[model samples]
Target: MNALLALILAAALALPAHAMPDLVILVRHAERAAEPASDPGLTPAGEQRALALAEALAGTRVDAILTTQFRRTRDTAAPLARAQGLQPQVIEARRGGAAEHVQAVADAVRARTGTVLVVGHSNTVPAILTALGGPQMTEICETSFHHILLLRPGAGWMQLGYGAPSPAPAAGCL
Candidate 1:
């Protein structure tokens, strides 16, 4: 983690004045349900988790919410968006093209000022963090839905947990 913080600090220091965002909070979509195979929404527990997410971020004045078209991602972002009174900007998550999608989200985030909340999938969250100038992150465990990656451009970052703790990951998992 110290390595990551060092990298984050180095990246922040290297950024030009105009490029730094006030803050960027990135997380994997809250726990998903078992219905609709195409795009499942949140479960009852997930709903609670979403509410917990809103509460956890209540102190931060969020300027924007970014979500994908999938129901899970949108659902994960809904509570916070409602609390902040801002419509989530849809940055489409293209299948088989995660790199492009990651870059797009990172670019959109950098273009914006103030706080930005990004609700992404397990597959994308880590990459997005790295794109946002943090270290390369490990994949979030499939059952681990409670971690929050907070980035303060030109300052530092923290990994926090929100809501009920998720079940433990398998050995060697992140």
Candidate 2:
């Protein structure tokens, strides 16, 4: 009887301690200049899409906002940031800070009780996801508008959610 009771107690205690965050949102910066040599700000269509994405996110629980140190990324997060009344926290991954940034974000997520938003560029987005350490990520070529990627945690792990941006209008065709 004693051995059986101990086994049952151990089994009950083996359950996970904490619930992983329900959402890990990944959003690509809105559209920018076609010509790389020119402006880095969002194009008109990108701006429109940003607004649409913002509206789409309205009333959702966004506990935190993270972004890269780029204009397009900052612009992409502005609407949600404003609505949440929280300044965007820059991830600073490019300045030889990828490891540190990843650790800091992991710590933040572990400490938090709800969803966290992270906005990144085409280059560093996959790295962030990879650092969270569930599976390898494939490079994603981003275009169109309102591109959204979501991540969520599961049985002792986390996984990705991916979606392409909505198609641009005919007038906005490249």
Candidate 3:
């Protein structure tokens, strides 16, 4: 009886000891073409910033990536996607600030990946955070650098804050 009880207790303790997702990176699209008439592609500065962000995340284990269906957002995630050797999974652009889009990505990340990066826009990034069960006011400001937001499976989420990734020395400017 004593041995059986000990085994059961050990299994129970080990259950929660399994690996959990560590980090979720939320990035707003970099500076876009000044004129909306030209279509929103990342500007030269934006491209430089994207490359810098990718370099900063080189050491992280990025299992998956998510982005909206926009040129700037896609371009912003491109470098990181290439570094991870994985294609960015573009979530359907949210219509009417829908929650389903956020839940779908969250569910996919929770079940399939250990770490996921989501690229979004200035207007909707905050909404995405809220939809992911974060606070309504969890605002990760739009910046050239990346913002690391941490979310546990069962526990609440928190913003791990920002990482500054200026353009590489060879690039000369950010």
- Relative to the true structure, candidate 1 reaches a TM of 0.87
Residues 1-174 of candidate 3 have per-residue lDDT tens digits of 999999999989888553446666666777677666535888788887688768868998889888877788889889989988989887776667546766665565555447777787655566666666665654433443444555654677765433345333222211
Q: Candidate 1 — which residues are off by over 4 angstroms?
A: 1-19
Which candidate leads the pack in lDDT?
A: 1
What C-alpha lDDT do the candidate models reach, one value each? 0.90, 0.66, 0.67
The residue-by-residue lDDT of candidate 1 on 1-174, one tens digit each, is 999999999999998776547999998898899889889999999999999999999998999899999998899889989988999999998779999999999999998899999999888998999898787878899999998999987677888998999999867556
Best by TM-score: 1
* Pairs in steric clash, model 2: none
For model 2, how does the per-residue alpha-carbon lDDT over 1-174 read when each residue is reduced to its tens digit?
999999999998997676456777766677776655433877787777667667777878888888767778788888778887878877655567766776666655655557777777654565566665444555445554454556665533343223334554344221
**Model 1 error, position 112 (Å):** 0.6
| lDDT rank order | 1, 3, 2
Name the weakest run of 10 consecutive residues (lDDT summed) in model 2: 155-164
lDDT of 2 at 32: 75
Task: Give the TM-score of each candidate.
Answer: 0.87, 0.66, 0.66
